[model samples]
Target: MATAPVAEAVSLDHRLGDVVVRLEFADDGPVRLVGLVSADAFDASRPPRPRVTPLVELSFAGESHVRHSHGTRHRNYAATSRLRLVERVADARRLSVTQRDPETGLVVVTTIESTTPTTVAIASHVTNEGAGPVAVEYLSSLVLGGFAEAVEADVFRRLRVHTCLMAWTAEYRWRDESLADVGLVDAGIPHPTSSTRTSYSFGALGSWSTGTHFPQGAVQDRESRQLWMWQLEHNGPWNAELDDVGRDVALSLSGPTFRQHHWSQQLLPGESFSSVRAVVAPVVGDVDDGIAALTGHRRAARAAGAVELPVIANDYMNCLMGDPSTEALLPIIERAAAVGARIFVVDAGWYADDAGWWSTVGEWRESRARFPNGLVEVTRRIRDLGMIPGLWLEPEVMGVDSSALGDLPDEAFFRRAGRPVAEQGRYHLDFRHPAVRSRLDAVVDRLVAEHGIGYFKLDYNVNIGEGTDVDASSLGAGLIGHERAYLAWLEAVRERHPGLLLENCASGGMRADPAQLGVTDLQSTSDQEDPVLNAMIACAAPSVIVPEQAAVWSYPQPHYSDDLNDFTMIQSVLTRVHLGGRLDLLSPAQLARVKAALSVHASLESFIPAAVPFWPLGLPGWQDEWLALGLRSGQRSVVAVFRRGGTATVLLPLEGRATILHPIDRGARVSEEPNGLAVTVPATPGAVVLDLIG
Candidate 1:
């Protein structure tokens, strides 16, 4: 394949709020998504000159296309090459590009809708109209190429790929690497026939959507000062790849694929399959602007749920550590009420009769031995203390030694090869089964009605490997069904209760993708007990979730020093504070300090939901001695600065009157510099939250 002769090609251009999407139909080839430029920056003269990435890249069984690296690259599949633009429909907020493959009678409709001024939601639907069934392996949800059109600088060197590295406790860690640094470099050949041999491909493989890497990231063009951020809105296996298409770069986002997640779907005649939804934002600014656009998209796309950010005190982090009993909770409850906690969540082990709760959960019954007066007694106490009662539940898994297994049918749990799928001594419940959903619904209703529970911390602890194969095409296909069904069940629960708050926690942020976050009211940022390390997670969490929805833990232990106590408080001040610790054991001075910090946090609640995040010192490293994160709402901003023992002077590129919002008596000095504000933290382990008023 070589460069085609220069000829004028027809394109269907549609302005989607903030960007102009141009679909090129050239020389009887596939309709390609060539231009996705910002409306303000769209260049009408430079229409795409070469074959860009197709809108829908599809691969089926036994179809071959010439000049396509079938095994190496996912672009230019045979099925996609035969797809021609059949019909297109557009409205004010959406554009639907429908392509037909006459050779196989496959219809691919790529629907793009403006989620916000700078973001769009995209998904592809494939339908088979042939007489025979087609085995489908790969299909892209969204494809955007031609980064070379953004700037004149070297695309490989100037384009920065921001990849999010996630782990159990250390989640939301961002790594910025250039294409050349990631091994995808320009070969210096003119109009190469195939894609680059190597690509910067990353994805999650199991049920934990963010088990290894976050499903969202940004590609920044440093020369043009433009950024394209995207999120694969799927709860199961998903993949995203950045590869070179000739001199330009392309991004392919999709759900589970046969090659990646052992997933394949057989589409019979008159049947259709839809890919996972992906939200993308292309902005003409830096990474912060890109994130702000995505935040706006998330805010616009999600339903109107609860907006109040209440202070929740859960007995899990440094206090109860899961073994919660009436004997151990009364003092903590009093202390929580004393510290202005609006919600009191009794975490795991509340249902256990003894210490053997690990392998005997899922009954959802209050343990008589743990709560002698029944769970209602504690709920009543919580209500009397002016706090809503909540409970932690791992609803998706039944323990191996639980009595509930005798009541559930084998089909109710995830099954493969005529057996239930067990992971870490727990059987994963298939929410696709009515029995499973019904049982969980009963549990929730009973707890809410009888115990007067107002909140539920939904925690998922185990990952049932690929998926169940019971009545399904493949493992990944079954997982997709269950994932969609689980989300539906969640929405149904919310509909029924309407006022109950649901906190999403999967072993702490493993399932923190937008698909889960969109429905849940709060997202547990991490289970990391060390507040010093949690600071890194808190600052970076805004890149993934909105500040008001991110529930970062602030557990100031009684044994901690004054500086350490303030450090822990600062970790969650900018975000939703999931307050936890042995507050009952804290001295008067420590309790006063904690109360003062929470007071400051309460005062800034109105500004957080509307604010966007900015890092004055850039995204923090794991061991970065000093860290600063700011949430800006127009001219007003609140900056949380932490000194983990580096240079005392912290410089911020903004000039405003900096008043100490928290720890007013701490020895932190602020001065107006010629270029910015210079803040001096006199102590090594000091922390401060500054309110900048211009």
Candidate 2:
């Protein structure tokens, strides 16, 4: 007996704490994202407003129609084609939607999991089901759009887009633009026109995942005070776009693609591939509210058995600059521990025996010339000082003159056209090869066992564009495979050395993507050495990374004045202070100030993990004279304000009753106002940390 499919419109709604997601289905037809609203804004009594946006969009080879063109003719079948729903399932924490395209033999299973009250993590898995290989051009992890209310005249005026631009020295530089200014909306009130269609897209090029821009953004509706924030959690080529689909705006988050980065994946029968996870959250307040929700989500997503966020002193930045030696680091180590650094890391040059050691790096052993008594003496000194021993290692690359370059198998290195892809006197390793993993494992194990090393600062310096075509269908696929293998190796390392702590750095803050961040313990915020310039990165980093995991360098030298020393120390106290610089060269008074700041950091360390960040002075401008950031936990809050070149008195919005408002240094004066705090600063640069007991 032939049975006809049910023709009724079916929908399912799931609530995760304060957020609601509703999915709609038409019999066995296409699936759509009908609703994604906060619990406070959603009205059950009103008729359902089903969004006309596809849940997932995919482009495959041999397809003719362009579903949603962004100034290009690309075959995007899943964009417009009817994706028949195979199954839908939901639980208290997650909702899964399974859909299949009959023409391409592609099955996409989208899962949305709630990590916090207001944040949902989304990921899509694509599998090839037919006999022949399917060439995938585009696969978006998240495709959300169709906000009709935003198209109204008044509402459209209040719409703004927020994205953070990043670089080597200046990271987390935020830029806010109106929807009309960004061409996402028309000039006049709501109207239909052929010229209204536009797309604003941005992404990174290679391994320096966040070199150009961060893979995170937010859209805010000022009238409703609602913000939608999202981040693509990948460490490689990634793209995010804001598209005008005629009636409404759309957002697509995906990795590399054929049209954009010459990336394509050929999936054979029964083969499957998964897109990088995209986390999206909706908050009912301002950007702070969105950041709070995302912070909670990040806390929930962190790996279990993570190390405590402690004060770490790395001998880099204003200090050694990859020239560490026994004589140079011993005094620094002694002073670092005296200032209460829980971890003392010997950053770079520990394995170098010559000036030309940069191109001869793959050997992880101690340098006989640099450390006469071997590295064990230094590690022992660090441990005896009541601190964990740490070292800097660039694990994924072999220097061009490295002996391992010839020792390791050719398949272990990334090769393009039978030649190793060399960049900046280094050859990238293809982690997909077992030889590469074995070599890294041996080096890590030897270091830990030989030196009793408890911490590792993993750094990646150069970008090997696209990737090498080895053991994969395309260059992008090869890169994806290597990334997955690297993640697996990291997991294995963590499993083996459960007590080891790893810090992620990329020339620094370049590879601070959620994909790599999910596995590592801390992130180096930036390599910017100047305290005044680093203030901008420190103030804005919490929006992209958890404050507890953001490692900001506080490097004070002898030449710095008392106010300058206080400014640098306060920059790191509010976050994971990666204390650096010539501690051995600092004067007694300057060292006292550094130790006092560490005391304050220790007092507040217990509350950092539970704290949610808020920008009292809004997102800091690149050239802003005054900047402020607050962290609220329970009824208490900690606010850090910096005065670079501002007026004498600057008013800061009060988060609560100022119970303990005091300057960490000597020149700054503080007073309470009716609705805010009036801070008076000297002409010289200074900073202060305020502890508000609500």
Candidate 3:
């Protein structure tokens, strides 16, 4: 009898900075992650075993695999199939592995790139090579298993999951829970009648994918201090799940969910699909350390060359809400430029014929009624004042009464069941269509060339569920395709106009994912007008976005007191200050304070980009009485402390001599103690930024 052909196996290891990834591949077999460890861990001699786990878990065409006693079966093609190695490639920054299923003609290419020493970005590209189409119900960007030995000994009790809960007004609310709390921990053995395997799933759906839950999460081992954090870098539907499968635990992070989001992708022969990229890092420290690594990753992943983070003044928030005109904007523009704002943005209403311009937005032309002398005149005035002219444009949506609604073909807009998808009286544009991109390109080119527009605030307001099923097999696939096209258009526009600055805003901070944040120059933290309420968002935003790119609104109203004005100004100083509010309505004394704060911001701008953030008071709660966030460079550190209502004295665990830089209250005092620095504010709400020099 002839012996069976020997299985071909190969092992490869890649090192990115301090992170190491080792892969074991069997020709015409499973591809597994044999090793995933930090430099320190790899250096230490340890027993070697089969750390093999499936590289990706996928299901397609209703194929079933594992069955449970509860009468449920799950299909994971990657776990069951014998994938042949098609190609393997690597570079200084990235390692790519390609595998193909001979039976189904499905090809999967997984790539991991090191954005920083500790952070690695992961993505998967799937292609259909068969004669017929393939319907993919599930695809994962990153999946790692075989953590049983590391976590099971403590009954998986020491593993803690951390994620941020988000909403309209309140965003980035972090929630930390043990694996046992979420029912992911193994509880001894399963009874004969019941199954022990349980899955804990969480995700966000619709256009506002991160509206309810952020696509960022972390799993930390309290005993070992090993932290694994990931952020799904997509602006559309996304999901993440943690499954406890008795002997092993697995994680699946993907762009969309089939069960809840009505998402599916059909790929024809020669058609390929790419999943949303995810940034995963292994930190040996706490959450703060993880965030620092992510920050470095963000900086590394940004487009090459220096990016300017200037002070921007928008005539919105508290000043003008979609009612800008040449007469009303000239004084505000001059005042904003006088106050050290490098970019003056006439937010909203410049293209409106009437107050009901919200639904007539797609035209992108200067409103004859709003600018009788032409919008170019106002832009010229901005340039005359030595400020970059900026405009607010919602490029992704066509209003019901928009001129483009009737002019553009139906294929240019997102459609479901042969009808355009409309939400809140606006139709979402399908960036996958060349016509849609052409229209946006013309609009941007015209504005930049004719009106001298150097800045744009791209805003999205509505949440259109799932996506359109036009030329695509699945709604999620179509949505993701449009998103890719949109990013490509942005890249093209940037190439054409290298100096144009882009700001990403989705009804204020909703679509502030890494994908969008990576492309845009700045992100609006929130649309909150109340200075007191914005403190929480401002403090927590750096955890999700780079501090240098986080645009915190500093809009002091006309009726605000000196302390209130100081509070709002202090909030904006730590980040990219999007200065706004009725400076045209403030008294000279109050405006003087604003000017002083701007001066302080200008002084601090040089050091902001190099600083890494830390929360001395831990992550702030939604209604925390005292919030403290510190940024440290080399020998100097700047700390911002806000005391809302509860205490008079807050002790910060900072071990250095501190000098008050910009104190909101004259009575505020800073003293050095053996334990830490003690900051004292008034009984009422107050704010202070202290410069700690070592």
Candidate 4:
């Protein structure tokens, strides 16, 4: 096909029902698009946010194509469409589309522009002419060749499906070849992570979904269901979906309460409709060939940009500890490295003798009995164990009796003439003060030079309050000064340890926003022990905009509600980003439980940034108190399932023909089928494994 010149006549409008798609671009530039919008209903009480697909690039045979039609699910409809219209009106030969609707009084106009070879933009606009206000829904979807599945596959989310209706929100069961007709169930229904993610929101809607996708022959007969983007609910790949949980969330759902993603809309009188234009780009294409086509951003950030350092995972028992001494966690640290713990950190209590004395901030020194060998011996031991040694510190804190605040010159602190420091009854540090900065710099330099510290779990116990102790009229930023001190510490630390990973903890989510996250590497997910609640933390994890890290509880805890079996299953399905748990504290059987959990953890831990790559709606009682469940990730696909304690029927989410490997009573069984995988497992409360086989 010959190309159109920059001065060529451009096609301007196209329509689809209530939507009028427009196209435009510059003669010497690439395509640009706009989506004039509307909503399904018009009421000021509930305003709707219209959706639009402003820029979509189509590709064919791994290259750009230029043709389009609504009904075909082949080639690339966004970039390679035969018509270079959406973003390339400059090259369009003839573009025309029309739509009629009572809600839209303006004639739907679409403009197509082709600014250069293989680049186009198509936009839709509806001018409100006759109606007072109209609400409209945005309709923009792309048909790109396999990048959707490719990125998913590259990320290892290939669940081969043979069903079309793809039960968007249905529950499924496992299969049993020995039992008549029972071979149709899959051990893991929907997807593994869906049970947790859907309840939380993390800003953008990216590579997330739920459903049954089975690798061919992986399972001969499991049904697949719940197929769509939103089904898997964590914010795309390599995201901190569970780590920075509490900080960045748009909505949340725990019980029967249904939080709408977004519904209804309001169109201002004579203002037409509010619209949002979306650019649909393939997440995976040849990175070399598709970066420009997809992200519009060139090369990726330097692969080695982040400073590499191991981080410690505690204040010992975490927030609950009034005294870290009682926890006996130091011994666990040595034992951890013995079993492969790479980063060793001495938690909170290591500072003040008790929590009440935590404000002794500026005077950080090793407590006596906690480490009789002194901090040096501990670091030596960590080195002997072949792991990097790290520690925890809340340099931003100050106690009334501490030397940094109580004894320091009043000129060195943040103080006001008469107002009480709102939150912290004690005084605060003046971060901007040159002396304060020098103090922190000395600490970091001392730690690095003396103990070979690998990482720092920088902690902030409380938000310092502005108090009369600070001469506010003359002492700038009484309370905020403390915050500024933290920033200075962060900048100094990075400047010192550019390759060190910084873990941020400000009473959990207090400072877990973008500004702080950009300076830190990892953040804890939550304080909750129950996987369900922790999952809520994981749901909000990725919104932090940093490296993904969700603190997973591994030890089979002696809790009130769960027995060994139930807890084991839940632990496996819990967040992937984790720090090893307290195996030394559990019972003997729970010790064995640690090994069991370790096997699963070992396989998935390194890939946590991938997060829950695949997840579909789970068993109906999953959110309820059902005790039996299982998940299987093998060769190319994964099969998971859930069943009630007394309910006899178990539904599987495997689709089409498959061959499976399962754990039966006497031993293991492997079988093949035309549609899906086949399996037979002993009706017990444990995982049944199956490799995706031919």
The model with the greatest lDDT is 1
* All candidates in order of lDDT, best leading: 1, 2, 3, 4
Query: Lowest summed-lDDT stretch of 10 residues in model 4?
Result: 249-258
Model 4: per-residue lDDT, tens digit, 150-254? Answer: 122121132221111111122122221211121112223233211111211122111111112100001111122111111111111111011111111111111
Residues 364-383 of candidate 1: C-alpha lDDT, one tens digit per residue: 99999999999888999999
User: Please, what is the TM-score per model?
Assistant: 0.97, 0.95, 0.94, 0.48
- Which residue pairs in model 2 clash with each other? none
Write out the backbone clash pairs for model 1. Answer: none
List, residue by residue over 37-124, the lDDT tens digit for candidate 3. Answer: 6665563344434543467666675764443412121224432455667776777778887877777788899888888889898888
Write down the lDDT that model 4 would get: 0.36
Candidates' C-alpha lDDT: 0.86, 0.81, 0.80, 0.36
Candidate 2 off by > 4 Å: 1-6, 27-29, 67-80, 150-155, 187-197, 303-307, 659-665
Model 4 misplacement above 4 A: 1-315, 318-322, 325-327, 406-430, 463-491, 535-547, 558-581, 586-589, 610-614, 618-694
Error of 3 at 28 (Å): 8.4
Instruction: State the RMSD for candidate 1.
Output: 3.1
Q: Is candidate 1 or candidate 3 better by TM-score?
A: 1
State the displacement of the C-alpha of residue 40, model 3, in Å, after optimal TM-score superposition: 2.2
Evaluated against the true structure, the overall lDDT of model 1 is 0.86
